[model samples]
Target: MRITLKCLLMSCSLLIAVDASAQIPTLAKCTRSANLLACVDADGNAYSVNTVGSTIYLRGFEVIGKRYWAQTSSRYGQLTFFTGLASDGEAWVGYSRRVGWTTINRFSSSGGSSAKFTCSRIAGC
Candidate 1:
């Protein structure tokens, strides 16, 4: 009876572990800065980001594809403002078959670059 109970508990624990693992979000690509962390999943379907005070949130309905774009103040609205300074305007993220994926700014015709000057990849930042 004791052995059976132990086996049942172990099995239950294993099942819980598997379920938890399945729910944990996978970080496919990410960019980081002193105040922010922006991550995309393997599916390119969602964005998980950190806002002020170390708060993290997920926004969705995104689809995985060759490229994805995000404009800070514009797309999501006021939420971006509270994230940090310079958290406005158009920001872009893209994926490539050969190079994997990256986040970059679109260059303007007048030599202006819509880039995040201070942010770095999560590995470095």
Candidate 2:
């Protein structure tokens, strides 16, 4: 009976750890100004977005190297879609609107992860 209890506790602990690691981080209190969007995640990690010509770039937090996203929408559209690949070859896709939130997804070899930010325009974009 003691052996069975020990095994059950160990199994439960392992399951808990896996669930915690699978959680996706979220960004809040985002502000957009001109060509840049700044945000802070729940864990207090900072992230920013910038546009150079027609390419969009995301930096900070889990980013390990510079990656540029290609725009996939018409310039006249209210919403924009972007896709890119991380330095480590992870696929990323994101979308945002002129007056709403932005959502980004990363497809990694070990499953995947995502982040959503509540965005507000600040002017001069």
Clashes of each: 0, 0
Residue pairs whose backbone atoms clash in candidate 1: none
Over 4 Å off, model 2: 1-33, 51-56, 63-79, 93-125
> Candidate 1 local accuracy as lDDT?
0.29
Model 2 agreement with the true structure over 1-125: per-residue lDDT tens digits: 11111111222111111113546634356788988877654544445667666555555443223332222222235555554443345554445545443322212122255544343233211
Highest TM-score against the true fold, candidate: 2
List TM-scores for all candidates, in order: 0.25, 0.33
lDDT of 2 at 16: 13
Per-residue lDDT of 18-122 in model 1, one digit per residue for the tens?
A: 123476745446677765655545654434343444233323223423233232222232122211111223233311111122222222211133222221235
Find the candidate with the highest lDDT and give its number. 2
Q: Model 2: which ten-residue window has the lowest total lDDT?
A: 8-17
CA RMSD of each candidate after superposition? 20.9, 15.2
Question: C-alpha displacement of 1 in model 2, angstroms?
Answer: 41
